[model samples]
Target chain A: MNARKRLQFGVAVAALMLAGAAGAAPVKVGMITTLSGGGAGLGIDTRDGFMLALKQAGDAASEVELLVEDDQQKPDIAVQIADKMIQSDQVDLLTGIVWSNLAMAVVPAATAQGKFYLSTNAAPSALAGAGCDPKYFAVSYQNDNMHEAAGAYAKKAGIGKVFIMAPNYPAGQDSLTGFKRFYDGEITNEVYTQVGQTDYAAEIAQIRNSGADAVFFFLPGGMGIAFMKQYAESGVDIPLIGPAFSFSQDILPAAGDAALGVMNGANWSKDLDNPANATFVEGFETEYGRLPSLYAAQGYDTANLLLSAMSKADITDADAFRAALAEADFDSVRGKFSFGPNQHPIQDFYIREVVKEGDVLTNKIVEPVLTDHADAYAADCKM
Target chain B: MLLVAEQALNGLQYGMMLFLMAAGLTLVFGVMGLINLAHGSLYMVGAFACAWIAAATGWFWLGLLASLIAAAAAGALIEILVIRRLYSRDHLDQVLATFALILVFSEGTRWLFGSFPLYLSLPPALTGAVTLPGGLQYPLFRLVIILVGGAVAVGLWLMITRTRLGIRIRAGEADREMIAALGVDISRLYTIVFALGAALAGLAGALVGSIQSVQVGMGEPVLILAFVTVVIGGIGSIKGALIGALLVGMTDTLGKALLPGVLARFMDASSANTIGASLASMLIYILMAVVLILRPQGLFGARA
Candidate 1:
């Protein structure tokens, strides 16, 4: 109650307030990803890779505090997470949704509200084309970008007949369209199975009877695994072509020997010879005790992009930060990586063959399917 | 002719697996009058146990045995701790409780095994193919699944017809209070039936795990189809489950194969193919609706 004591208390409060104002709180990020469901593998890898980048970014990560939440691949939950991030956490940046559906749910709405949304993996055509936003940046290629590479690869292989298969959904439709755009061949058949369909037996029978020389399928996650297993066992040896999601490092081990020799198109691979990629692959393997999938690679690159952008511009300035991200000064694990006019990645697509390196099954880059290719939807964006 | 035969065989294989899952689900539902939604969780448990054990031991058969044991034991434990209380409760409460079990099992398994799908390879003895008559080579593992399912069907039929447990189950279904008054250890009977059903589902999971990706939530899709099979077959009847599964599997497979080409004859291939594919996916549900309308109780369902 004494005057001297009260004076000391006032001084202490002033010092505390001054210190709080002087040293800034860490850069806050909110990540909503599918982590507990069937698609958890993809989301988990993305989160791990993103965190690994933050950790290795040294002092940069020290300034970053990430709040991670599982969306469970549900759009409603993703929206809630985004709302919480924007309202409660007041996050500087938001990222980390694995599925295209989830991204479509989160990105447009989040970015429209003036929060920067950096996509780790899904880049649906809606965002890339006419709906593209300046605040939205896709560190990953468009959904169709890699599949087009597969189609291009098939065309180069001189396959006379190509039977196409995909799940009956928007992405599936995109996959088939992407393939057909580049592939010059006799279309034997185009069959769309139910989404999340595990049994490909009937489809395989159709393929066999169709007399197709090659097959290109877009059945991601467990669908791809099921299809590949059944296809391998069915004794139909026609070359199977799929996008990288089908033959990624995470699911490759589960697809077993069936996935071996299967060809896929990807923007990033575990075995890319670039120094950045080499550091990422080695560090990721050492840290996680498994090879990084393309999803992980995308997550790593997105984090690096965000950090570099943050260093270049004040996070509070939207225009400056967006411009800095567009600069893309960070060394991408994918060599020669850059953003297109639509804010989606413009990167080379490699034809990777699933070959066993020693006892482990992994992808090896065979050849370039498309070099410095931008998505077909980039031109449609008015932005 | 070849495509038809091959498609038919595929249908048969898929149906048998469903029958295995449905038989257990129906038995549990009929005898206990409990609609256990966590049946899928048990399937997932079987798959994870089989995958982990097989990987650790490097023996597929041993893993199969472990799966059956693990699922059965888990089922019995769950029955004792949770399902026993639900048996006296209404279907809604039972549903909610079992639904909770699904989250528990799924998250628990994910915690244990991580999110990556596990691959269970076919045994060496069952690997490769057998050229049937006219050189229609089918994967021997799939053929073995067919054979094993047939044997189980016969074995289940014999057990139901010729065993005391079967008599108790049928008599219990007829009247729960009467069976209880007659000194049937009702709780023990329920546990035994539940464990048996869980075993069947677990066995199905083990058999199908090699052919499909073994991962979390792997069971839900198959479980939904199995429920359809059980309902269309008449919920409590083993024979009905078999018949309904075959119908579903056959319709689903053959429709996917035959509908597209047949529809192509009427319209342009592209639009027809798209319509046919969706229609094909819906064919089973259509079949179920038709059956429900024709016979409310189901094909083999006994008069209530």
Candidate 2:
């Protein structure tokens, strides 16, 4: 009786231990973002913000494993990292690319391979439209949303003639198109500069002579900082307006007082009035010793969304996990976050004014520009 | 008309900066016969040094001085440690070695300064615009840059024509073996020339850093333009570099400013802007190709 009972008990315990291990095994997430070169600020913020969310979750996030890598802001390197993450690392989800060009190179392929991709920053229109995949979700707004909001704001202000400028790229083209879609005013001039251009003296001279009441531009990262400084020094006092990419926390310090009084379109800000946002802004500062940009907010929300989905459904159940992610049951710092038809965010956009909060330059929400905004290409998506 | 005038001034300012970069590159190539791709890394070193010192000391001028010293020192160190070995090697070896140095310098910088860009502000005195003829307002700092470039050009001309060191540099450029045979202390001269060139590049970086973001890899874009300037000006001619830089700068700036307007006369504004910008970016290269076709030895290059 003793030998038979002892053998059965040992077998039962070993089976139970194996079952627990399978159930509690962490969900693997691969983050491929720029962490070197000129664009590292955005990627560092993304990684920090995502890690912050995981840290705050503490015991609740015990079942999550994160693997982070730098893409160096290059499309080829991003593609290579994506391939490695999917094939060798076998991560359940991939996220954290800062540039649209890199995202375009990596996202379609990764999603096609049946891996879920939660975009932290880049939300290219191509991926939002006919290229949309059920396996991909953009936690941030569409690339056009902020520019479209700027256009809407210009329209609301009744600006008669506006000068618009952007870099010569797909996202840049989308920026101007989005602005024109919402504003019915006369465009005094439409200029497209070389991508990564540092000098804007020629553009400023044209803006001064164009008889435009306001100027709109969309130059992100280092390009934006350069243009803003040069524009400020050029003394073209025409009111400057743009998407928040140029005026985010990451850029504002480098731009210094040059960014003061500029109005920019954004979906979130540190001064946003919500419990979740307040917690996020304060937590980010306390954790990273700096203010969080909208990119950081997006990264935080992406991680929280994954956590919520994990709580609702097991990662092994693809359909259930997709449905759970679509639910977006997390409290987003952006307030009232929800996915549109194409799985891109449908959210309110606001006009933010760059002002000095103490010694630090930061943005504050002045007013709402677009209410429950959705991308124009969502109708083209089949799923 | 005012817009055109303003753009021309902009072009002049841009050309001045390019001249600073190309002068050093041309000198190094002419005297050393070495292709140094890491010249841009020295420029970056200057910008980072300026930004860091300026932030620490709260004095922009002090930062500028630091940029020069830091870049010159870095240049001399590399010359002694790495570049000296490459002098006897082939051009491919030099290129490979310098290219590897770029990676090393970039990673080392990232390690020291972290990844985010540093801010370098213009002093209050040069912060505002000055009114020009026809009511055009231009930045005072840019005018300063133009003045500084002109002064340097004059200074370099004087040195080349009058100084003993300049004569040695010229002689070295003409025949390295002859200069060495004459007991010119060739390695020391090479180090000095390289450092002098690096100092020029560093000054350009510091001057430009106030306007642009002082981030790692910032020098690469300007480096490409400097290479273009060198090729167009003849690889070894300082005067040629000046003229080529201005030509390239003017072509680039004016093409960007006027091409869209010209195209808008025939096409819709959006398509005109898109197509015109694309064409404008290619304008400088086009100019270079035309110059090469017209003068195979470059505008000022000596015939082989």
Candidate 3:
């Protein structure tokens, strides 16, 4: 062999040994979450929760570097951030997205390119079933899981002639269908309003006139705040049921006393009695000076999941990392959290009633509607 | 019949709010010949000002007063510092500049008061529901809004036709150079007009704040609808704005309430709902289009 060729080979070997001896590189997690704009409340909580978990990870904090960027709740902007994170920053893991629509836009693309995306909040149905990707995992429940729990609760409560409403969009459609999946009661009416609509006076009037015994709606964020305010003023005095998103701790203050006595379904609540959850809730409330919502719980859990897997296997080794992640060994804030076959949570969903605790509006866990509840779509997922 | 009555009241209340926004927008567009996209920001600023002050002072009336004052001050400052230069410029420049101001106002508001929305409650005197003629129950605050809009409309008509300032405003709208030649201080007139328009918008925002969550981007959606109302009405006509707002508001409210129920008589429930919802959202736009098709300008648009 030529002398120069032998030297080049030797140098390459030395560099490889040096890299191997240094161990795996630090995991770069790029969070493309909503930080500013209308839904910033949810995104801000998610970011705070995720960062808290990482900060409390002790030695694991050194093993991860988070690059947070605000998507401003725009899908096109989310796509751009995802592409840049994948191509430019070359993040090892992508997490902490807030909305389902934004998730549907970026998740498939990010996972298709072989980047692991552990979702903190969004759990679109397509991702849980037919469109499920091996590299993607939802640390949160399926988008419909909580709504289904609400339906189950309504059925148990014998709510007949139910009037339902949601925004006219994919998530909204999913919410209605999910409610109907478990609910066999006679439906008086089902209405869909415009997405991002802030007024519901007309709809409230119809609900008043429909002769329905109960009302269920899936409007989230600002939409929920508007509906609840108007509903209170209309003096309809009907039973109001909804998914937890509308009555979440993050938005409950804005909804005011209007949300009092609203029954919602969710997998986690601040009052959940568990060691991990107690630690998370206390740590979070201490750090952020506010109660962590379901969004925040999901974000904190996502980070802990990544940290747990990182502790087991080097992130550079894709096969080993996937196996470690699928093991689901992390202590989740939502107790008894485990991955379904589709990498979505097979966890308990409880009925939470919004009640005033010492003049502060918050949710209290009423009953466990579904224990170790796996999504209906999990069976449809071949993976 | 009861449903119709209730929906109509809702439409009127919504239309009144729209008029409050559209009137100022049309007035600025007519007199200054400048498209002020940031009119909505003024609305948001007013809402925030009201919410912030109300929360601090614990009095709804005081908050409302401060919101109007703050909005007028903001409008006057913008006219002096930024808007005056764009007075002679084209509509595109005005649109671009005002659009930029929306971002500035939104971001600045966010910087001052974080991204979370603020809640404003109705005054204790006007908080409950009132029963109408046909056993239809409505919020008193909303009824007040409808009445306030009507009073403002009548007041606007009187001011424009009877008062000297109103004559100057009308004259300024007719011809800027001619008004200036007739010994009118054109710049001061523009500032007064701008501030008046802004104050109306602020009042609308403060009034609506009790019903709606006050946030930074709250103004943009209302602004778009205001622009739609302005187009539907004659661009420079207050009477046109009033009529157009009512028409749009009625179409939207009644369509949303009635369409799904009507469609369900023909199709299955869910599909009927899907189509009804889609159409309900587009109903106002469709009305606008029909108005434009029938009258190349608008229902009350002046022929060039």
Candidate 4:
């Protein structure tokens, strides 16, 4: 009750207030995905991965306020979501996009605003190359990395000639260009169908006539199912191959016996043997009541990577957070990962085959395609 | 040669499927004088019902039957409950109202089916491929689609031209009040016409679903294309629908298939590739615009 004692108590209370403001304020992060359309499964999985990673971190993430939005798979809407998140939410970071076009549309705007954009999916090559910016970091591998791995695997398997197909879109072109990077053999035919096209009989006939040893494609979502069914019915002797997105767990159930024996390359499969991955797979299944796709895995990793950066940055400093993300010093379910110079992930790629494992359908890893394969266009990025 | 034949047949089958969808949209517009943007929702419903029932019953045929019935029933219900309110409204209001229906139906279906797509397989009878002359093999299911589409076209033509209901429908199109004054029970006729349109859409959905994943919103993009088809063919003309559907489908398929090759012959591969892809994608839309310019009303439109 002395004047000196009262002044000391007031100073102590002021110090406590400053410390609480510095360490306890939540790190607000914004995420956007397609939660209401044809691509909803991918979006839902991404959301699950993100939230699961947060759950695993427990109360530690209580200091992180994650704001999520559904883009409805529209590019314009994605841009709007990105804008709203940055301006209204005042988010410190941004992540989550399943489609390449949506990512391409949103990433640049986020980066221009000096916000860190950690892409969970939509690793469009432009973003890896000329479009690359320091503020943008991909939590997933570059869009073409998996396809390039597929091509390399096919060459390793001694495949002489392949027929390739994809939707006639920017991403579809990326799929072919990536495959051709490592595939030195002859391409008997390269076909690009309409984006939402359902019929594949003509393409199947063309492939059969082309006399290719195998067929590689980049038809994701409903397009994949249609092509596989038609390919099966067409009696094309060629084996089918692609990245896991076209025919993974989201698609395999629909593909059924037709997709059996199809080869795919990916960064994560349910059959990956890493302990961190195993825990993730089990936890994801327990939480979501379904197998997690690569999209989900990437989304989950984005959150973990953000956390790693947040811890390194003490949760507030922008420049330090950006540096920590670029360092990518995090234990991921995809195992240890680091970012290459372009802020695109330099990670392992695995060759996997569609197979029925007990009562469940999943991809079983066949072999490692590459260890930390840096994307081809990283030099073009200059970032 | 046989390969070309097969491709052309495939194109024709696809065109016929387009006709079924376009027919429903055109009929609803022509008769009701209302824009129904949720027609595709009915198509989605048909596919989902077919897929769900097929899985539950282990019968593709039964599923097809159920899809048609379900789609038609849904069409009637929607007409009575929602569409009837907008009959006298402006086209823009009708468009907005139906657009809202699209949101409700799409969300409702997603809630029921979850996000994962459902696969509907062909029956064993339609699974095999028969070798055509010149050593080209074609899937039986595609041939069946062509056959079924053709049969529907013929059956539709007969029903419209040869039946008592057909006369009333044509009369209603010319003068709605006149048909009503003649005691033709206009409300019942509207419901029947709407149901008929819905049935065609359902059949198209079921057929296409066997080939594609039956997923929510799958019918939307196609529905837009169907509208383009009717507009190009001449709204209120079944004959125009067939012509427009085939023309649109072939132009779309063939332009996409051949554009890159043609461009590659004259230009550098990369430039040709880029230009060809863009042009190929835009071919049908370009065709639509040209038709609109040339005919104004449409190539087959009946100028009132």
Candidate 5:
């Protein structure tokens, strides 16, 4: 109650208030990804990439806490993880979803909470179009973007009577849809099997019987391995084509010789020749002792993008930080990346073939499908 | 017709694989009355063990043997430590506890093996393709699987029907307390049964691992299908499990192969595709539903 004590207290309070007024609290970003099951190969790589970038970026602005949870590759679990992150973790930003269904389940919740969501992967078209949210941004391209590029490449390669197969799911439909969009040739047979199917011998038989000149499949994860292995063993001479998923580094080792000469398209490849990518590829291999998959590349870029946005923004201001992210002013391993109006990535897609470079097998660049191609749903996105 | 025959063979192979998993499940259930949701975890263990051993020794036979022994050991350890206490507990308690075990096993596997999938190579003897009567060139490995499955079916039947241990198992299933009173060492029997079931599951996982990517939680989808098979065949009945597995497998494989083409005749390609894919995906479930309707206790249910 003394005069001197009261004055000191007043000064201390004022200083604390000034500090609070000058900058925002420490930024917290939540990530939900699969840490188990078939998708774990991609999910864990993504986690390592993001964490590495975060560490390289130095101390968290105001002490950034990255809250991470495992979706476990289930939709219900994904939703629960999202809810827990939003409510318990109290993360102001959310990112990291590799599966399209999981992304679709998580995005609306983040956006409705006024949180910025940076999608590391999984770019369903609806989000880019009618379902777009101003606060949501994708560090990776839309789901269909890679497949669309594959279709265009197939057309250019003079492939005809292509038999298309995909898992019978929404994302599967999107992949085939994307492929068919640019492929104006005759599709001999379009088959959709149950999601997570192991044996594709029956479908392969059907394809062989149909006399299709080539095959385009969208089998991802373990399904890809099983199908490619079986297809190769069946001695079918038809050229097999698909997106990066069916023949990625994570899958190729399992597919073994079956993966040789398999053509696909992707946004990022181990062999991409950009300086940023070269650094990433080298650093990832040295750190992890394995070649980085596309998932890892996207994950690394996601964290880097966030850091770039943070450096650009007054870290204390949430609105400014969100705005900076929306602008997407960052160098990406994919060479170039910019956010379209729908907050999804507008990037290049490359046609790649599995080839042996010395002792190691990796994707070799065959052609570029599109340069700075925007997503098809951008115009539909009112935002 | 060739496609149909090939697809039917695919179904048979898939069903036999299911029988391998389901037989173990039904054995554990029929004798011990334990739900053991962690059965899938055991399958995963078998796969990992096979891949690890095969890579280390460069011997496929040794790897397969290791898978069986590892799986059995794992099953015995689990049964003694955790599952033994759970035998007297409620199904929900068992389900929740086993579910926890699933998380532990999954996390443990990931921690030990990291996230990359392990690949298993086929033995050279079973690596090539064989032409079937229908002019379809099927993988020789798949044919071996079908043949092994048939042999196992006969072997299991002989064991259960003709052997003294089989009689003891049957007696134990009928009256656990009486069998124990007769000095059958019930605990040992239970452990043996559990280990045997786990070994079967492991063998199944090892057989299929070469064809598929061996990874964490890979056992779960197959486990679900096995559950459907057992349910449709009559839970706790070995014969039921066999019949159910084959039926469910054929329905799933053949339905997927033929449904789209059948629909295409009457509808446009796109519409037929949408309908066919949906139906094909649901075919096994539909079969389960039909079985439930016709025989609530299952196809070969003993009078209860």
Candidate 6:
């Protein structure tokens, strides 16, 4: 009511408003990933790895506001969550889907709406080829990279005849094709089992009779675990090879000794000698009390990439942010990570061997299979 | 000739596993008239219990025993707490309640043991392959499963045909009200039968878990196959379950083994393999439909 008191209040309000206008608002990110069911292990690692990077950034990442949701590995659920995040939450960017099918469902729509979609995993060929968009970035390798590496490895090892198998799905088809692309050997058999098939007795019988010098399979998650266990017991001495999805750290424990001595192709391993990787492996083991898988590495890189872009350009400017992301200036845990023309990763691939490391079964880098390898679909992308 | 024989054995092994699951499901349906969707959850429970105990104790035998006890105990507890209330309810209500129980068990198990799958290694004695007649090298573990499944089938047969509990179960299946009026503790008998069925499913889970990854949803795929077996075999007949399981298993295995090669003769090898594999997955359902068309009440329904 008094003139002096009113003036003081006015001054305080003015100061507060000035301060608020001076500081930038935090960038909002929506992460939808599998956090339940059988695939939860993959999602949990991704979320944890992403969170660890943000935690390490400390004050720098304070401007990031993350909203996480569980997809339960369902495409419809992922789409619904994406819609909610873009419309209601008004997220500036979206990320963190583990499966390619879910990525196909959410990424195209999200990018069309002018939102940057950074994939932590699941880079299907469809999105990498004619479907490539300016705003969509795959922080992981293209789906075929590991399989291609396996094929190249098989060729190098002089395996004359190979038997290949995968689940009956689009990714499965891509997997076999990727392997065959680089492997110039006689394919003894190309078998497609049921998506979630556990019984492989008949398949094993076929493998035994085929007398292939080696076998390559792309059964991911629990399918891989079951196949490995069954194959080990079958007393079939044929060498086994596959992509890293099956032999990842999350699965190696469940697989036990069955996974030992198996060769798998991967874009990165925990033992990769790089300062960024060293810190990540140490921090992840300390925080989560478990070894980090390639999914985790991808998650860490995705977070760092986001952070690097944020430091360079304002997220509100779509063009500036897109250019910043394309720079990929972050020190990736995978050592050498860069984007291809289609915005998918152009990275080195390694052949890893499963070995016992201090009572824990994990992978060690055996040799580099592909150097600066780009995807087969990149040439098809108009972008 | 050798491959055919081996494929047949694989079919038999697969059928035996299906028999364990279908027997339990059919018995629960026949006696209690309850469509228990949570039967698979009990299977998952058995696997988790076995994997956990086996890993902790380093004894596969103890883990197998624990699987049976744990699954039976879980079944008994659920029957008393949730299932008993639904006995008088319609099939839809039983299905809904049991479906809810599946979520509960899955989430509860995930809470106890994290999302990662547990390992259950085969015993060393049963690790390698054994040469059979004509130099057929078969995995000893699978052979053991066949033998064990055979033993259980015989044991179940004797119990059902010759034992007093079996007679009561048969009488209960015929007329529940009459059995209750005859001074049978119908509630207790239902609990016992449910537990027995649960025990069998759990045993299957534990045995199969050694060969497969023992994870949260591991039971679901097998559960679907078991349901198909139950439908193909009349809903209430043990003998029907056995015969139907074998038929389904054989069809699925043989179809997968021979179809691709057969189709390659007509078409290109790649397309033939793809088409044949897809068709092979559908073979069991086709068999079921054919069976249903011929005999509306199923292969061995007492009503027909």
Q: Candidate 3 on A8-84: residue-level lDDT in tens?
A: 99999999889756855689999999877557788898999999998888887776889999997789999999999
The estimated TM-scores of all candidates read: 0.92, 0.94, 0.94, 0.90, 0.89, 0.93
Ranking by lDDT: 2, 6, 3, 1, 5, 4
| Residue pairs clashing, model 1 | none
What DockQ does each listed candidate score?
Answer: 0.51, 0.60, 0.57, 0.45, 0.53, 0.54
For candidate 3, give the lDDT of residue B129: 88
Q: What does candidate 3 score on TM? A: 0.94
Q: For model 5, which pairs clash?
A: A24-A316, A123-A143
Tens-digit lDDT string for candidate 5 (B136-195): 888888888898788888888898899988888888788899999998999999999899
* DockQ top scorer: 2
Better of 1 and 2 by TM-score: 2
Worst 10 residues of 4 chain B by lDDT: B268-277
Return whichever of 1 and 4 wins on lDDT.
1
How many Å off is the CA of A353 in candidate 5? Answer: 2.2
Q: Which pairs of residues collide in candidate 2? A: none
* Residue A310 accuracy (lDDT) in model 3: 89
Q: Residue by residue across B32-83, what tens digits does model 4's lDDT show?
A: 8878898898888889889989989999999999999999999999998988
User: Candidate 3 local accuracy as lDDT?
Assistant: 0.88
Please provide, for model 1 over B91-127, each residue's C-alpha lDDT reduced to its tens digit, 9 standing for 90 to 100: 9999999999999998899888886677788777877
Task: Give one digit per residue, the lDDT tens place, for model 5 in A1-383.
Answer: 89999999999999998986776456788889887766777788789888877766676534567878888778899899888888988888888887887888888878898888888878788788889987788888887888898899989989878999887656787898999999999988878776666667788888878787889988777678778777767766788888998888878877777678888989989788888888888888888899988888899999988888777785447678778987777778988888878888878899999998777777988888889988888888886
Every candidate's lDDT: 0.86, 0.89, 0.88, 0.83, 0.84, 0.89
Off by over 4 Å in 5: A1-25, A59-64, A315-323, B31-36, B79-111, B114-116, B173-187, B234-237, B263-301
Candidate 4 stretches greater than 4 Å from native: A1-25, B82-93, B114-116, B267-274, B277-304
> In order, what is each prediction's RMSD in angstroms?
2.9, 3.5, 3.5, 4.1, 3.6, 3.0
lDDT per residue, candidate 2, A205-318, as tens digits?
Answer: 999899999999988877788888888788888888999987888888877787889899999989888998998989999998899998899999999999999999988898
